[model samples]
Target: MRAILFVLLLLPALCFGQAAKQKDNPITIGTKQTFHSAILKENRTLWVYVPKSFTAGSKLRYPVMYLLDGEAFFTSMVGTVDYLSALGKMPEMIIVGIESTDRVRDLTPTHSPFWASGEPANDLKTSGGGPNFMAFLEKEVMPYIETRYQTETYRMLVGHSLGGLTALHALVNQPALFTSYVAIDPSVWWDNQLILKQAQKALPQKGSAGKSLFFATANTMNKGMDTVRVVQDNTQGNHNVRNSLLFRETLRKSKNLAWAWKFYPEDNHGSVPFPAQYDALRYFFNKYALDKDLNDSTITVDYIKNHYRAVSAMLQYPVLPAQGTVNSLGYISLGKKQYAKAYQFFKMNLENYPTVGNLHDSMGDYYVKIGDKKKAMEAFRKALSLEEVAETRKKLKELEAGR
Candidate 1:
């Protein structure tokens, strides 16, 4: 009898839990959205991941990251951004992973009959459609994402293999399309180093200037050979890495762009994307680690403002101080009896979030800490006017009665 009653009692709760999950909680990282591209004449799939802080009514905007090979690496990229942004190592981003339909036709710049082994192949007849694919991305995919989401002007491109080749093509020809590019183990030997020559011409002429790039090379050399020996060897299997190094030299000519490269001997072509992308993110946002600089005694309001201003300038996007972070900093200062610093932080939060009742309440706490009853009353009144809270009402009443 008790077991029957227990099951009956739990049935509603279990059903409610299931219904809630089905309604509000998504089981996957993000929704699979489709857009029909007139440029490519097909429906393209986008696996997009927005930050946890994203909400329908929120005014916060974020940079966008367009990743190639969505089906293969979307989850990993989402996890990377989530972890790094949570730690203040980088800004939260909207990751748009593009799933490939006809990769060879879309990624390769010039159609080639020869394989990577310098031998003729029959399957690559659809090669060299990358220009149209790029148009699909720029015209269709980008406009779709930007119009649907609240995004900053800053955008980043990430690709591997043939996708990486497309990224370099964009960097050389359409440099202004994205703010940063991460090309991992790029197939630079494609179409007889077509992009390599373009880069050689464009890079010296201020191509990719004022932009950020991080390209990685994997260990694609022959057996019993190191980098130097492999570069010296002109064998068919070594064309990719050799041309990659050649592109690296070309990248050095462009003093205007911020670029970094690493050769991964431990990781081969198939196994380098995860670690390479992780490192690429670090290279892209190296100066975004605020925890290293923030401490109880050393950090000031002016320094925090300057740090975000630098980030804004570097990314060419406006970023404001996070309200929660500043609030915590204010309380931290208050705990340390640094009244002036506490007041500055609280005031900054109020300025950033003027309509947030909690911020006005925090300001009331700050005024009370400094024993300024008049200002404290004003703050409590403002907080109460925004939203009625029992604690704020009590504080206002106590101040009004001169207690």
Candidate 2:
């Protein structure tokens, strides 16, 4: 029964390796070799998604999420990451989808007869390999990713169902391994809820200020239903809902360990990953995504001008956008000795940012360049009065010298 279900569930995902050979848009699918285990000879296949902004000129490095069940989950995760990152709702980061060699053997912590009924041996069963799997990830996989890509120290670990259980195990046993955790519908029933018991015993007694964990679950079996048949019908589970809620409650009363948890009664196990992955991304970069620091006011005139020259085609230069993204096109035109273009941007910026002295001053610089000294002096004098900075003072001095 369970054995048949396991095999059936396993084949499609295993066959996904062949399908992964076909690339999806903006996502590069590939494999890597790591000597993570001797018994598992083949290393692992990893799917990677590098954002469009990850060009040669980009100076930004991104955080990472090492996801399990790559064969089934990689494509959707990549898509969500791409959409969110482009919208600036989340920081651009790499998604590393790690495929398993043999999930039944590796993803589980301890060996038992519940799932493997045919051959239950003392110590020789092809189970209890999770520790070695974790070793492969921690030692080989993580180091390889860090070395090959521009990654930051902040890392996230994400897993679904059994993978979810793996993430929780990592959290309790190796708490310092990752900065964030997104566990979707983890199997608390594994080994008679061994993980739940472990969590209860080894629970940390601290608030989650420095670290974060976002746990979620979907609607599992509804009361009197046969879970196995229901799983086959819907191809999902809701068991994690109860477990995630319980986990949240446990953490709430424990006094430490920062945590965020939600239950989606509307979502099932298979469908939960989509929304959960997106929400996890928001949670990870919530503070930085809405930051107004990078808006027009805080940027240097030179920097804006430089940016305008490069991104004007994308931003449609000189309209002086007041909201959404800052317009660097206008600023860039000013820097490139394009006096007319610079004036166009300056005037447009002035319409929205009229109180901002820099826009007027910039327009005045353009006026002086085109031999309109009166307008240039007016712009510079306004800038001087609004706020005297080194660049503005220098411009004022230049105007005085010209007179």
Where in model 1 is the C-alpha error above 4 Å?
1-26, 372-403
Encode model 2's per-residue lDDT on 206-229: one tens digit a residue.
333456778877776676544334
Q: Write the per-residue lDDT of candidate 1 for residues 1-403, one digit (tens) a residue.
A: 9999999999999999999888995567787998788999889899999888886677889999999999999999999989998988889999999999989899988889777676787888898898899898888899999999999999999999988988888888889999999999998878777788888888888645569999999988888777787778878777677888888899889858899989998999999999998999999899876654445578889878998898888778888877777898899999889999999999998888898888999999999999999999999989998889998899889889988
Residue 127's lDDT in candidate 1: 89
Q: CA lDDT of each candidate?
A: 0.88, 0.68
TM-scores for every predicted model: 0.87, 0.62
What lDDT score goes with residue 31 in model 1?
Answer: 77
Model 1: how far residue 359 lies from native, Å:
2.6
